[model samples]
Target: MGVTRLVSRRRQDPGTKWARIAMAVLATVGVIDTGSITLKRWGFLGELTCPMGADGCDKVLNSSWGTLINGIPLSLVGLIAYISILLMTLMPLLPGLQENKADLSRRTWWGLFTLSTSMAAFSAVLLGLAVLKIQAFCFFCVLSASLSILLLVLSIVGGGWEDSGILAFRGVLLATVVLLGSLIWISAVDSGRSANVGEKVGVPPAVTNESSIAALALAEHLAVGGAVMYSAYWCPHCHEQKELFGKQASQQLIVVECATDGQNNQADLCRSKRLEGFPSWEINGEIDSGVKPLSILADLSGYQGSREF
Candidate 1:
């Protein structure tokens, strides 16, 4: 009777229900945050009105670190993580799980702790990259990191664990593993550091992709229409924009090197134009920033030869 009563009392102890509620709310916001970025990257949505300006967001998001090995947007990974956290937070509250609520709650709390720890660790890695390597301020990235840290904190405060030592051990182990894995993945995909070593100091990477006939025609048409691409040698998005045109087509386009140290630089003209971001396009005497799809560029340049690009 004593043992049974002890078990019952322990089970009935009121956990921090408020913390779970807060976690759910935060996770929902995270879902929307990451989801919007994913949609924009996939071209399902138009340009995002980032706080401060679009330049930082564009630089960070179009960098080589922005996508996974398979070319999927990194924001999609955050979206999936947020959705999983949301489901875990709300699952034990369902009416069907009421009979096993105590046990389910215990297990889910552990799951939340592990998952949130991994997220927070990985977020730290990304933050380091944004600060030290990418050297850009990404509002969405900062928001996601904040959310992950908060989720980890909530998991700890609300778990009501009996063994602090065990919790500490698990957290340390998981974080170390996550940090190591994140570093390895980042090093593998960082083209700025690895692939451009032999090139001149201020030269951009060579365009490796082949141009389609449609792409070639579009490029010629853009050149004939007096379209100009303004870019800095260090800008990843500029390289990305060139890659879209492929090697042959990219050579045909009028590319002005805006960086003072870049080869064949036109710094004075770029300053005269008051350029705000890399890879800005001057089409029909109108300046626009960010990387444009080939089809959009074709339209902007009044290219009638090829809609296939």
Candidate 2:
């Protein structure tokens, strides 16, 4: 066979083995992220409330980031990617056709390459937006980011690295498309429409009686209540927390980044703080986890902000 013909081989390279392990980890992350969001959205997980003691899960989920492109939950997207990674990584375990071994390897390589490259680039952008643009954290979002980062590493070290040149080039082209699309769409859209930079809109604060931007800024410093929020940038609920605080207010409270990639990284504080879940809160140091209603949260925290809890 000509060297250029790409030889018949198995994807079970030593590196592929490691990549498999990494994909397993990302898969687990997806499961955790999706599971949490499901519970929160369904009201099965409502242990924590906001400073106003309001429930804002639905509010945030209904927002933009919760879904991708047209209408796909970010969790579903991660689930698909991780599942794809799992399948591609485990391709070796599949029974090979009597005469299509080389074709199989090439196909698997191309698939894995495509999946990993797109996911990695997307994660990078989401993470950047989470901190610099949105200035908020979502445990699930960060979890996905970490998983994507791992997948990217696995793709590179895995045997697919050799086969990924074409995919990588394509990935760059696609990334350019995405970036340009975002720039164009954003430019065409309302500049005041909020650029994923978490900010306040809609209703004004009923509690503090002051929704002024300055008041919102002061609220952050006053304390975010005894709440432990487990969040990832990719998580809509976490963004809900930011929305509640009005972008500027969300920056004041202490946050934990459970996502291993340090997506928002309130300084590796989650582990040190023994944070157990995303969007979890410790009201007066008492643990009340998950997306919660502002009213209920206020009651729990003894909200004295002039808002009924």
In order of appearance, the predictions have TM-scores of: 0.79, 0.51
What number of clashing residue pairs does each candidate have, in the order they appear?
Answer: 0, 30
Model 1 — TM-score against the truth? 0.79
Q: Model 1: runs farther than 4 Å from truth?
A: 1-15, 191-193, 196-203, 209-218, 230-241, 256-309
Candidate 1 local lDDT, residue 252: 93
lDDT, residue 34, candidate 1: 95
**lDDT accuracy of residue 268 in candidate 1:** 87
Tens digit per residue, CA lDDT, model 2, 1-309: 646543224444665656666666676666666655655555567533323312233323434555555444565666666777777656654676526645665666567656776776777666665555444555556667777767666655564444446545676887676667655543443353345433433321222222445435334434745355555543455666656665455656565555443344553565465543457776666765566656566567565554421
- Please identify model 2 stretches exceeding 4 Å from their true place: 1-12, 42-63, 68-72, 95-102, 160-168, 182-309
- The Cα local distance difference test for each model comes to 0.84, 0.55
